[model samples]
Structure formats: structure tokens, C-alpha cells
Target: MEKSGLAEFKVEIVESCLVQPCLPDSPRSTLYLSNLDNQPLVRMAFNTLLVYEACENVLPHPAKTIREALSKVLVYYYPLAGRLRKKEDGKLQVECTGEGVLFVEAMVDNSLSVLGDLDQLKPSFKQLLFRFPFDNALEDVHPMVLQVNHFTCGGFVVAVSFNHCVCDGRGVSHFLKSLGEMVRGHVKPSLEPIWDRELLKPRNILVHDLVSNEEKIECKPHSWTPPVYKESIQMSLILDFETLKYVKDGIMPKCFDICTTFEIVAALIWQARTKVLEIPHTESVSISFAVDVRRSFSPPLPNGYNGNCIVAACAKAIVQDVITQPLSYLVNIIKKTKMSLTNKYIRSIIDTDQFPLDVHSNQANIILTDWRWLGFSDVDFGSGSPVNICPMHWNENGINASNGFIFLHSPERKDNGIKVIMWMPSQEFNLFEIEIESIIRKYVIKGSKF
Candidate 1:
């Protein structure tokens, strides 16, 4: 095995296949992709890592069981087996030919001890963890791929790669849970996947008469490739309850008794990330975050609707304005931005098929995505619950490593607050860490009744 600058290991590929439904369940008709599903997912694969401790040794015959379960699950999620092809109009749709999903199995020479904490998946470590061995060029056609890596210490990691066009983080969790159910001897999934794109299809006529031109959505059609920050690194930070409560109380309005957790956390991150970068005070910077539109729409999306029902909410400010503002000031901005993500705005964007609009953000143009309720903990494949589940960004498309993007998620084992995993320029990371810690510490001191 040729080794790079990162740790070296001999990876042996045990098996590879295009897994299809054991029983024949072909799509009666071609599936037309929905507007929400037609987003960036089509261009790249969203990868994830689930690590489990080596308590039981079931390596004897987990293969046939796993394959059979995947086949059963595939019967319901058939689009995974279909091909995404562009139509005459240049829009993409799925040709449900039941070609099947790519599945790979490999064995690593090392153990979890050598791997340490997987919370922050560095690029070098990511090389061993990525699901598909091939490059991003194959993602558009191969919508889903899987890899199971067995470590020498008996611990194993399940890596999955699926197209972003098919679904968002919630949908990925749903698909994985289905696989887990099948792996645990259930013939059918707990929640059946719904694939009717017409549910979100735009009406032929303009529906809103009272809406003004100001609220109209903008369409930006341009090919964006993910940015590559070769010099940047990923860092994970845990926000405890005391830190969160202090910050939230500091930001909460006097008249208001409470505020959302996201508002306070987002505000702190926005300010800290921007300050650490030491951007010019006059420069305009924006932050991009995603808001789920499933329940936000007039009629809620189906419970099992697996598609990209998310929109970006962006907020911008001059660098000086952000750095000088009080924590409450920034928190209010984030709250107001979220409040603006109304059903009206969501419908407008859906009807126009426009790009996601910026909502609440940190300058230096950092992007933060919330995945607290994605339910990765429930994804147990015959073994006990996973010790850690880290998401790998869709770096192939427009999600570059140097973009200062981060993910905020609930702790792996039920802690009060959230954790952040982000990638940024390595040079500023030390100061960035200090800035964030002190931000909370300052709030904690201020919130004292004294």
C-alpha cells in the first residue's frame, strides 16, 4: 500500500457490488425529480462515518445478513438503484431502472486506538474513512454507495455516501435507520420512503396576488465547485450547559423571558469566527445557514418525504459592526433573520426554483448548518448504538474545505448543549479557539446577579 503524509495502513478490499433488491421491485414509471431534490445533491455525495466499539465479534457471518437486509430496504428506496439523467430541457430526473447501489467492504490493518477521536475528521484520516474510493465524478450517476471498514481491534466503521439531490441530512438518517431495521431482522422499514415529487411541484399559475416584488425570489444559475482549502483544518468544540445558559441569558431581551438556543449559539459563532479572522472593519461579510422548509410550508411535507426541503438563510454585516456589537445585538439579528423565513418566503422560493437566500450568518462568510435532530444515534446495524457519528461534507461540489463552514450537532451521547465541527485556515485556529471560549466566559461573568 502506497502511503501518503498521513498515517499509513494496508486497506484490503474484501468485496464490492452494486446491491439491488433481492426481490424484483421496479418503478412502474420514471420518477420525476422535485425542485427541492434538484439542488446541489445531484452534483456531489454527502458522506458520513458511524463508529462502533468492538464489544461483540460477529465477523463470522454478518455479510449474508447485511446484504439480504439491504436488498429488502432497497425495495422501498428504489431511487437509490435508479440513474439520474438530464432531460431534453436540461433538468435532471431519475430513470428508475433498478441498477442498484454500490456497496464496498474493506479491512483496515489498524485499530480505533490509533484513530483516536473521530469527531473532527481530518482530510488525511478522511482518506481512509470516505465511502466511495473513486473521485466525485461518479456521484451524479451513482446516487448511493456504502463501505464497511473493519478495524484490527474488532471495532468497525460504516461509511455511507449519498447524493445531496436525493435528500438532506434528515433524509440520510431515515435511509440509514431503514437499513438498520433490516439488518436487525425486520423485513420492512419503520417508515416507508415517499417519492412523489408532485407533492412539492409548483403550480402552473402564479398563486400569490398580494405578494410584492420585493419578496420575489432570485434565481442564480451557475456551476459552483466546492472550495479546496488545503492549508485549512477541522476543529471540534463542545458547548456545555453553563456556557450556553450564560450566553442565552445575556442575549435574551429584558421583556422576553426566553430565546431559542440556535439564536444565541449562532450569534456567538458569527462574531467569534469573524473576529478571529481579523477581517478589515470596512469589508462586508456574510454567513449562510440552512432552514428546513418541510414544516414551514403551508401544508407540511410528508413525514417520510426524503428530499432536499431546505433553504439557505443568510445575514451580512460590516466586519466592524459585528465585532463591536453586543452579544444580544447579534443574537437579535439571527432571531429576526429566522423569523423572516416565513411560509410566504418559502413558497416563493419553491415556485421560482431559485437558489437559497442568505439568512443569519457570521461575516468572513462562514457557513453553519444545524443537524441536531438528524437521528444518527438510532442507526444501529445489529451492533449496539454507535459511539460517534461524524458527517463528511459534500466537498466534491461547491463545499470547499477552506470555506469556513461548520456543523452544529447535539452531542453523541445526550449532553445538554451542542458541539461544532468546522474547517478553517489553520493559522487563525488557535486564536479562534480562545475567542470562542472567552466569548462564553465573558457572558457568564456578566450574567452574575452581582
Candidate 2:
């Protein structure tokens, strides 16, 4: 029996198998991955869980329907059904062997209500997804894995884990959308999948040589080291649109002409986290976020072209300025950093292979990625859209903590607010929360600026 924080329950796996492409003549050729896709930073598998409430009179079993839909969808996104292989040059490519991805049908003993708060990532949530206990390299296992766990209340959870090296958040959402389309009885996917990885190859003339090199950070080869934390936790913080607007209004007069909600909220959290960590005043701190470059290119990547199209955009400043400066000061730094992500700059990143090396080495760095715009909630699997979608948060060996921030939409969808989920050391989390509340009370509640 697995114990969720809210209750004790058991998840029994009923069936597990490889789901292959439905088409008999699916292509069996090798596909090259782009430089962005081959980066070491995104080598691991990422997991997410989608929750759907019980339907009144739906007849077909959810797992059967989803499995069939997945098989059909794999015909279009065939690379997902393939395995990742490494070349002599140390880059990754997909071997289209039609081996297919893993699919599991599971049954949970408890109802949706007994699962407790779906918003919080709990230990029992691990049971919702199939777990591999044995040590196996990524190339030795399936690239895409899905498990459909049916609750006693007739609801189900679609927990999926896919290789991040193949595609990014947007790309996965696009693939999921296609699977949903198949479940809804669509003969063909609304949008076709495109594979133009070669188009993003380094050009003849290097971009850095042609442009100013001041912004170019030294390129460093990424090395993945398993993390170990003494004590860690994940917490969620909600900030309503009203509160954000109030803070922005107070700071806009002191900062740039336009301030986005993301900029304002991110700046506040960065300031709070930096202050709580008590970083050295002389140390250099950075805030890194992903910026999509699909539309930034000259010809503009096609609509269906889903690959890793995001680049890390970073804002850097001394620790003293990050903590002591006004909130608007950090906001301006963030805004300016984002505005600097011009088309040429994005090209330079690919051509020079230079990414934000600071994010990996700097102890004071705070990394954030926004899921509010990722379109995960928009995927419908015949029982209507999922009520909630969240990451499957757990540490390897129960001691490793993923340190980062994610901006998610309000689960209830009743308000214009967003949820910021953060993972850090447990002791630091308390102090960080205090700093956040202090900022909110000072600025939004009392109409005072920091």
C-alpha cells in the first residue's frame, strides 16, 4: 500500500505493454537532432500528470481509448516511438525502429477526493506513474512512457514521462494535442509534424564575429551531475492579478514604460529568494528564463515545427544590487535582458554554442520557466479537458531537490491569478516565504514600495 499525505491507498497495475504505431508502413529511418535538442542540459526525462474528473455516462474505458489514440498518434510523430542513439561525435539522434513507447493501465483504490490536494506534489503521486526501479541508461529505455491510473470515482490521471532531449514543453503539448484529437475521432491530426532540424545548423559566417561580443558568455560544455540535498521541499504561492497590478503600478513610475506581469512577479521572487539565501554581497547573481525563438527567426519556424526552440535568457547583477535595490530595479534589469533577445542574438547562441553557463555554476542563480503559456491545460482526451496539470515532483533517492521556479495558471481557473511553485532547501523555504509575505504586505496591502 502506498500512502499519500491525505490518505492511504493502493495503485495496482493491471496491464503494461509497448504501444506501437498503428500504421504498418511507418518510416524506419534515422532522424538527426538539432544542436539545441542535443544539449546536455535537457538530457533527462521530464514527467507531468493530468487529472480528469469523473464523467456521468461515458462508456468506453479510459485506458483502452487512450492506448488506441496513442498508437494512432504515433504514426504522425514517429520519432516519439523510436529510441535515442548516440553518434561518434557525441550528439543524439533518433533510431526509428518502431519499438514504440511504454503504456500502463493502473487502478487506484481511492476516489479523487481521497487523493487530497492535487495542487501539491505528494509522494503518493509517484504511484500514478509507472516507476522503473532498475538502473538503466536513458538510451536503454523507452523514450516516451505513459500510465493511465483510474480512480474509484471514475476519474483518471494521465501521467507521462518523455525524454527532454527530443522536444521541449511546447513540443510535448503539441504531441499531446494530437493524441487528444485522435481520441475525439479525428481521422487525421489538424496539424502535421515537421522535422527540419538541419535548418538550425550553424551558418557559414559565425554570428558573434559579425556582432558585438560583449553579451557573449564563455561557452562551456554541460555536464550533468546528480544532485543531493540535505532537506528540500516544494511549495506553491499564488498572486492574484489585482495584487500584481498594484505592485506594478507602484513600480512602473520608477521603471521602464512597460512592465509585464511575468517581469514584475519574477523580479519579486528573485529578490526574495536572494535575500533569504543571504548570498555574499560581492557575488554575481543571475536570473535565467527560457525565451522561445520559433518566431524570432527570419523565415519563422513553421507552425507544426516542434523541436527545442527555446534559448536561455539571463539577467545578471551583483548580489548587493539584487537584494538591496528596489523591486523596480530588478524589474528593469529583467526587462532589458529579455529585450536583448534579438534574432541575431538567438542565432549567435546556436552558432557559437554559448548558453547561460552562469545558471549551472553560480550558486546565487534563480532559474524560472513559465507554464502558463505552455498550452498543457488545452489538451482534451475525450472526457473534456483535464481539471489540473502539474509536474510529477519527486527527488531521486528522496534526497535530491530540483532547484527552480515554475509559473502556472490558477487550477480553479476562476480568477486571473497565477501560481508560482518553487523548490529549494526546506530551511531556506521558510525564510523565503517570510520575505515574500513581507513584500506583499508592504507593497500590495499598504501601498508602499521597497
Candidate 3:
């Protein structure tokens, strides 16, 4: 076999395989209890398997070529092929004791569907990789769930659901890109993965030690104890770049030039939510923004580095203060928080070795994580590219609340704008919608002068 450029790789469908499960001993079995702080974090691993009708031109033997590529990619993630375990002392650990890949067949035809709606075919894929069924001890050995479906036109989609604890968004993307490169015949990966956990080991910082008494204070849940609230949430209303720009323009002029789309929009929504919820002015609210820390490493993490490489930067203030403060002030605070992503801070968190295991109840909170910057648009599963991609469901890390928000680029539009999909309580959603409408209307007549 001659070395070829990435274009020489082929595509084919292979039956997904499931590995055999291993029962943990009494001491090792206890690790499962610690993950119960929220829900168990499991990684769903799958690929959109598309068979190319044009494979004759692309390769000599499509099936053989694709199998070779898959083998190569699998070897890279070999270190991660294991199940999570807990020590008797409650420390969580991952043991690489699993083998073989789990797979299933798709019920639908290869033609007549689009690649972007790959998730739609999950129901018929039949063989699930992992399900959290308690006490049965003989748990399935598959670490990731596989969804195989055919597109309406002719192709297949392989989507994997990975536990966030196993890898973060960046890590997953790196794995996928490497797979794609292997398929395309790029034998040597551009960014080799690093597995030395010691590189991220935390130093001794009394205030930041995760297991220390003082560090536990920071992780302790807040005690607001407000009336219980609940609401059904769904993904709706996809906005284009122009609409988002229009909304941003409306709020920018009210603040100094330093304000960002996130802070401005967050402020408006926070104010509207307070009024609609009829929460007292004295009550405090906080916005939790997920910040990527890839660049915070001393020498900077490699592009292929995976795992949770992010931290949350939270901004808290009374509802009245948020509504009354200049947008500039809020923006400045956010900027300062972002600047805190120094190596010291990251080392502190990683060293504390404590995952944020508890949810703060006292703070009225909302989560904002931007997928726009994640290069989702570049994910090409052999059918042009995904028209749009959004997480239909997100569970794990105590972010299953109704107030979470995930923003992605609008796949329908080619412009440099963003689409925000927010999951807020019913009252908060209504208030946010009304304010957004008003802001859009206001910006149409008068643009930002800032």
C-alpha cells in the first residue's frame, strides 16, 4: 500500500460491535456511587457510516480501505477503552478493561435522507451501547451508544453519545477529525494525542485544593430555598445572523464599547425574567458561562488533546443591580472573568482534583455555552456538510435544568451570525421572548451608535 493524501481514503459500512462487560470487585464497585452526585457520565461513541456510490473513483476497494482507516483511528483512542470505577474511599477512576467495538444494523434504506438529521434514525438502530440499568451487575460492556441511520437521499449516519466526563466537546471533535483524516488516507495524524495525566496535576494551593475543607466551601450548594419551579423545555425558533445582529445592536449603544453579545443579551433576559417571575428585587441571580481553556495551558495543549478542558466563569448580581447597571460594567466584569483563565487558575482547578459535584440552589442561574466557535460547520460526513447541528438533549454535569442555553451557528444561513437555543423556565422564556421581540423592533428603526 502506497502512502496517499487524505483524498485517497474510502467510505464503507461495517457492523458495529459491542465489547464484553466486566464486573468490578467490591472496592472498585463503589466508584459508581460518587458519580451519583448528579447522574452517571457515560460516553456514546458512534460514527455516521456513509457508503459512497462514487467509491469506484475514490478507491480500489472501498470496504477494505474503510476498515483499515477505522482500525487506525481506533488504535488512537485505545487508552480510553474502559469503564469507570470507584474506590472504597469514594475516589472515581477509569479502568481500561473493555475490548471489542459494539455495533448494530440500521433498518432504513441508505437513500432518501439527509445527513444532518442523522439523530432521527436513532430509534431503529436497535442495539444500544449502554443504558444505566441499576443492580443487574452484568452491565453491558459498550462504553458508547451508536446510532446508525440512512439518509433520505442515500448514505448513513453514525452518531455517538459519549459521557461528558470521559471527554469534553473539543476532545470528541479531535477524535472525529482524526477518524476523518484516517478515512481520507492521512496515515500520520497531524496532532498526536497526549495521555500524561501528571501534566495537569494541580499544585498545593490551600484555597484551591479541591478536597480541602476550604475548597469544599466553594463547592457547597447555595441556600436560597425558593419555591420549587418546573417547566417543559424544547428547541424552537432558529434565528439567522441578521436577526441576532439586530438584537445585539439594540443593546450595544446602551453600554460602553466593551460589551459583548453574551453579556448584553444575558442582562436583558435576566431583567425580564425577574419581572416575569415576580421575584423580589433583593434576590440574586447568576449567569454561568462555559469557558474553553485550551489556550490556558503553559505550553498550550495540543490540538488533539481531549477530556474536559473547560471551566465555568460565573457572574452574580441582584436582579435590580443587573437591570440598573450600565452594560459596560457587566461586559467589563465578564471580560475580567474571562481573563482569569490563566495557567494558575486552570492548575488550581485541576489540582484540587474535585469535579463540581453539587448544584448551587440559592442562585437563580442560567448556563451559556457557545458551540459557534467549536467549528461544527466543518463536520462533513460525506453528504456535503450538516445543514445544522444541535444537541437535542444534554444530560450530565448537573446542567439538565431548564435554564441552560446552547448556542450554535445557524446551519441554514452562511452569514457570520449565531443561533441561540435557550432552555429556560416557562415564565422566563416568555419574558425573554417578549424582550427579544422588543429589542429587534427597536434596532430596526435605530442602529447602535456605539
Q: Which model scores highest in TM-score?
A: 2
**1-450, model 2: which lDDT tens digit per residue?**
012247767899999999999998989999988878876567667788888888863426999998999999999988888999989888889999998889999999998876654545556667888766437765787878999999888898899988888888888888898998998899978987887788788787846443432233333332323234575656677788888887887888889768998999889888998887676676666788887778889989899887888777778777678888888998988888887777787777678766644455554577888988877888888777788777765655653244588888876673678888777666777778899888767677664545
Task: For candidate 3, write residues 220-324 as lDDT tens digits.
Answer: 234444445554343333455566566565555554455566665555555555445555556666666777877778888766656566676666666666666
Q: So what's the TM-score on candidate 1?
A: 0.86
Separately for all candidates shown, the number of backbone clashes (residues 3 or more apart, or on different chains) is 10, 0, 31
Give residue 435's error in model 1 in angstroms.
1.1
Off by over 4 Å in 3: 1-16, 19-68, 109-141, 204-231, 243-257, 272-274, 324-329, 354-363, 394-400, 414-416, 424-431, 447-450
Reference-based TM-score, model 3? 0.71
Could you tell me how far off, in angstroms, the CA of residue 305 lies in candidate 3 after the best superposition? 1.9
Error of 3 at 448 (Å): 8.9
- As a whole number from 0 to 100, the lDDT of residue 100 in candidate 1 is 89
- Alpha-carbon runs more than 4 Å astray in model 1: 1-7, 40-42, 57-64, 119-124, 127-140, 207-230, 254-257, 356-363, 394-400, 408-412, 446-450
In angstroms, give how far residue 250 of model 1 lies from its true place: 1.9
| Best-matching candidate per lDDT | 2
Higher lDDT: candidate 1 or 2? 2
